[model samples]
Target: MVTNLRADAARNRERVLEVARAEVAEGNVSLQLNEIARKAGVGVGTVYRHFPTPRALLEAVVGKELATMVQLTEQASQMQDIRAAMEFLLRRTLDLQLCTSGGLAEVICAIEDADERTTHAKSEMRRLADHLLERARAAGVIRPEITGEDVRNLMAGLERAVELDPDRADVYVSVLIRGLSG
Candidate 1:
């Protein structure tokens, strides 16, 4: 996305993104534009020009993570062991969510307001996840009632739980995987 901007504008945008990424990684999702502007040494107008709202900035920050999730799902869908694929996808997705401190989850949860690029990434993620779920069901590895949306929301919930109790992340993942299995 930054490829189109002028040199200085690209630098400013990168600075803003760096600051915003740090804030989100630290669980400070407020992402106030003025604060980001001050921290990035850019003017408020620069911040606005680059990202009009906190969600826009957040989408920019977590865009790569969303893409990674889609890639992971695609890879998972290809594996022969459907159950192992599901566990791998869930674990890796949860790891990404935890690394971002739930920023990806926040963006995904607000799909209605997402930009076109983010929406497309989310849709692809959903489609791939549903494909994985269907394969798991056919293999009799996952519960018949569980849908892709349930998996996504459950992963988000696991991320929140891990945020609150970091030490119990492994236990939480194990329980979630077990609960989802047939």
Candidate 2:
């Protein structure tokens, strides 16, 4: 591990991660290692060296993308405008779920499970929801009874809307907001 890989080798590793980001969650995260190696202009052995197991590679790829959502959620939580944060989180979550419908259940499940602990991913989601809810409730825009937990569930199923009709994502999102709003 101390030995540094050549410049090309380092770049190839990054390329593999990038390509796998989208492909991994699709269940096709299992894209042929050889093909990735080819795309990365490296030998299959190099890919093996970086990721010895299929599961390890999938975890790495999906983990990185999940971290991006966590970050967005954390930032949204800190925004001064509650409505903006709420809207941003909903839209970004929807975008990710819809675009990755091929394997969304896993991602949603991953987030949901993580929210049970104080992990960075879970904490980000909670923080964002709390900030948004506080603003909405104060504005009397969201139902007083609405809890951050409800938003959690709503976010998880936002992807389900994708399966009904891809073109009606906006409508589904609207419905979600209405149902969640006071």
Candidate 3:
């Protein structure tokens, strides 16, 4: 009976997370716990018991994507061609950001007091991104003045542009890459 109850609780938590993810993916950043509970078909107490706060829920939703970003940065750092690696990182990062409805950017770029895991992931990504930038600059593939923060802000701007005009994302990225290469 205890095992069954634990299994049921786990299922409820997963359901709440699923609904919350869907809400964020639909561009709903102001995740209301009560609404998530309603959509999850679970009680408010259950949702609170699982997530405690909206920030907690948002962190959970974006955590995987954050890890993926870090992984992409690490992968880019290992590539033989610095220019190609930088382009690959930019494209993959933008793709991931677009797919997550910009949630990853909101969390990593805007949120300052994220939970420990998220904070650590953000730091790791920044470190790897900085290393990639250094390599690109050393190889004379990109402008020497561009910093990681600049790249982050540029990507955020591109995300907004793509959101406004989805068809031109590739063109926008291509233009960005060309401009960065100088």
How would you encode candidate 3's per-residue C-alpha lDDT over 50-82 as one tens digit per residue?
778888788888888889999999999999999
Q: For model 2, how does the per-residue alpha-carbon lDDT over 1-182 read when each residue is reduced to its tens digit?
A: 21487887778788877766656555374567777777667788988888775545554555545666677777787787776777877888777655554343354344433222224555565666677688789977688898877775676676665666778878888888788774
The sequence of per-residue lDDT tens digits that candidate 1 reaches over residues 22-95 is 99989987799999999999999999998989889999999999889889989998999898898899889989
- After TM-score superposition, the amount by which residue 142's alpha carbon in candidate 2 deviates from its true location, in angstroms, is 2.9
167: Cα error in model 3, Å: 1.9
Clashes of each: 0, 2, 0
Q: What residue pairs clash in candidate 3, if any at all? A: none
Q: Alpha-carbon error at 163 in model 2, in Å? A: 4.1
Worst 10 residues of 1 by lDDT: 106-115
Query: What are the C-alpha RMSDs, in order, of all predicted structures?
Result: 1.3, 5.0, 3.0
Q: TM-score for all predictions? A: 0.94, 0.62, 0.90
Error of 1 at 134 (Å): 1.0
- Candidate 1 overall lDDT versus native: 0.89
Q: Tell how far residue 21 is off in model 2, in angstroms.
A: 3.6
Worst 10 residues of 3 by lDDT: 1-10
